[model samples]
Target: GRRIRKGAKMTYTTTYHSPLGIITLASDGEYLTGLWFNDQKYFGSTLTHNSIDKELPIFIQTKAWLDIYFNGEIPTFLPPLRYNTTVFREMVWNILLTIPYGTVITYKDIAQEIAKQTGQKSMSAQAIGGAVGHNPISLIIPCHRVVGTSGSLTGYAGGLNRKNELLQREKVNMTNLFVPSKKNL
Candidate 1:
């Protein structure tokens, strides 16, 4: 176990060797705050304010969960998560948790769900994309499970290649899922 310091506060950190890439996990010594592919978009954005130690208990537990997950075994439960964000983003993350393992959902579908939950007439998929793209925690929260309405792999902060790798690992049927055309090829 690593000691924090004489007076410095504790910040937990650890790494997971995922099939897709190395993943960094961080916590406030309690709830997991972030998990991302080493170079994923918005990586570590949530824990930049604190110093880190790699031997925290939360980090150990998260690594264990990742171990089971990457072995193609469904994690019996989610690791503890804690984040500070807007209410809508929190709601989006909660909806993400409801997405079953090895299945995919569309951004439009998430938007519709949010709209239904909030009693709104409708919600914008673009708005949902913004929330999803900014998700600080990656795999544990299952952001990669979201796809585009036309079966396009729209956006994954961890890179599309890693997203595909994760889906394949989970045995998700990708028969119709395809990367979308950006401008040309």
Candidate 2:
């Protein structure tokens, strides 16, 4: 969930018609605060302050970026993304950014990367999962590119179907990407 300090910041929001569905883009007039699929997990977390306007410059830039992305062509660069979160989540998000356009990584792999980055003997994949799962910015940060230890298309806050679609759009080979037969309770 997101926390908003009284009179300290203003969150602006807008909707974009994405190939997957309507996506809500939130910003604090400069840096992007959050992006969420319609009805997705944590859809409006911390979105307490808001002014709905489609013409916000950030929204326009983000839409253009997404247009290029959904068309199967990577944008020349990512739009400005500004989010405030804990250090561990920030590290996980940075690692997610390095996942490449069409490649996927396991939670275990991310945990190992975090360990290497933080100089720890070991890290927990589940801890990495907690960070990745709560990523405020989804596609731009490439959280959908993470999978399970077995290459299974596992938990995605944006839903597994959307995750699969995004991967296919990015040209990830789904032949090796399977789903767990049993759902996690």
- Number of the predicted model whose TM-score against the real structure is largest: 2
Candidate 2: residue pairs that collide: 2-46
For model 2, how does the per-residue alpha-carbon lDDT over 17-83 read when each residue is reduced to its tens digit?
A: 9989999998887778789997899786747654666468788899898899988998887778887
Give the range of the ten consecutive residues with the poorest summed lDDT in model 1.
2-11
Task: Give the per-residue lDDT digits (tens) of candidate 1, residues 1-185.
Answer: 75556755455777888777898888877789899899888888876556665677778888888889988999887778998899999999999988888999999999999999999999999999999999998988889999998888878999988888889999999999987777723
Off by over 4 Å in 2: 1-7, 183-185
Single out the weakest 10-residue window by summed lDDT for candidate 2: 46-55
For model 1 the local lDDT of residue 134 reads 92
